[model samples]
Target: MIVIVDYGLGNLGSIKNMLRKIGYSSMVSSNPDEISKASKLILPGVGAFDTGMRHLTDSGLLDILGYKALAEKIPVLGICLGAQLMTRSSEEGCLSGLGWFEAETLKFQFDGIAGKWPLPNIGWRDVFDVNGSPLLSGFNSTPRFYFVHSYFLKPLEQDIVSMNVSYGFEYACGLSKGNLHCVQFHPEKSHKFGMQLLRNFSELT
Candidate 1:
């Protein structure tokens, strides 16, 4: 079974509904027992970086989550703030992240020509699957996903980047490294594209 990690944040119901719509069953839980039994894990979150990490720490699922993702190497997906938590740190907060990747989350600083763009880039934007990851499988045309954030990821290793997006300038929007994967957009709110992406994730071994 797939377990959506409920760390006091995220669109849990929306994610569960999307998964169900795609014919995949999932449970929302913060229980370690339920999480340990999961074949795959989806770490979903929103809100401030420090707060998200604090909630996860307070939930006492961090150790098991780390074990599952790092030791057991289960298929783990992180979304939005969850994705940021995977990095080493973030400019938005002083707290250390999950450190799944050698990356950092940075706030969008518009200047010069880029200054025309607004903060908290909130809308559907085009995404380029540069690496053609299986997570993005079956996308015939250019795929777009719903994004609502003021921060973006800057991975040290570019090869791990699966998708890139441009608001004022290009930045990594999706990442894939072995059994770990993450996306900056909200697939649950993305309609057909979201459904297809979630379906693809379900098919991952």
Candidate 2:
């Protein structure tokens, strides 16, 4: 069964509800054993970088999840701040991340167009596939997903980027490498396209 990690840093109920709507059986728990036994895992987060990491560390899930997702190669999906936690570090906080990916989370810099758009880019934005990821499969065209973040991941390896979203500038929003998958957008809130993406993830081995 898919396990939605409850580290006190995410919208656990909403994610579980979304999974239910998609007809997927999932459990939300902070129990290490339950997490270790998961066929698939969803790491959901909605908060600051340091706070999320602290919660995960305190939840006693760090090592088990590391083994499952990294060593054992179990399929894992990280949403929003969860995705950022998969990286090495973040500009939002000084804490080191899970370091699963050789990437860094950076605050949005509007550069010359600073006043043109708002920070923490909220609302819907279209994401374009970069490498035709299985998670993005079955889509006839680019799909727009809900985004509400001030920072984005910058993976060192360009090949790992599954999709990108253009704000004031283009940034990597979807990352896939081996059994690990991460999306900056909230598929759980993105309507049909989001549901399709979640469905695709549920089907992954």
Candidate 3:
């Protein structure tokens, strides 16, 4: 069964509901044992970087999560802030991240185009598939996902970036490394596009 990690953050129900719509059953749990048994893991989060990390740490599932994602090598998916937390660190906070990727989260710097686009890039945007990830499979056309964030992930390794989206500038919106995958966009909130993406994830080996 898929496990929707409950770390006192994220749209847990929405994610579960979306999965159910696509005929995939999932459990929302903070219990380490329940998490350990998950066939696939979905790390969903909404809010500040440090707060999410703190809650996950306090939940006492960090070690098990590390083991599952690193050792067990189960298919792990992270959404939005959860995706940010998978990086080495974020400019939003000082606390270290899960460091699953050699990357860092940074606030959008428009520079010359600062005032043109505001913070919290909130809207629907098309993603450029860099490395065709299985999670993005079955799309006939360029898929667009909903995004709502001020900061974006910048990975040191260019090859891991699965998708890129343009806000003030093009940035890594999706990442994939081995069995771990993450997206900055809110697939649960993106209607058919989101549903298809989740469906693809459910079908992953």
TM-score of structure candidate 1: 0.98
> Would you list the C-alpha lDDT of every candidate in the order shown?
0.93, 0.92, 0.94
Q: Which stretches of candidate 1 lie over 4 Å from their true place?
A: none
Clashing residue pairs for model 1: none
Per-residue lDDT of model 2, residues 42-117, tens digit only: 9999999999999999888899999999888989999999999999999999999999888999998876875577
How many clashes would you count in candidate 3?
0
Please provide TM-scores, in order, for all candidate models, with all chains considered together: 0.98, 0.97, 0.98
Give the range where candidate 3 is weakest over 10 consecutive residues by summed lDDT: 110-119
Give the deviation of candidate 1 from the true structure as CA RMSD.
0.9
Residues 1-205 of candidate 1: C-alpha lDDT, one tens digit per residue: 9899999999999999999988999999999999999999999999999999999999999999999999999999999999999999999999999999888999997776535788799999988887887777898878889999999999999988989999999999999899999999999999999999999988888
Q: Highest lDDT, which number? A: 3
- Report the alpha-carbon TM-score of model 2 versus the true structure: 0.97
Deviation from truth (RMSD, Å), model 3: 0.9
lDDT of 3 at 190: 96
Local accuracy of candidate 3 as per-residue lDDT tens digits, 52-164: 99999999989999999999999999999999999999999999999998899999888887548987899999988888888888899999999999989999999999999
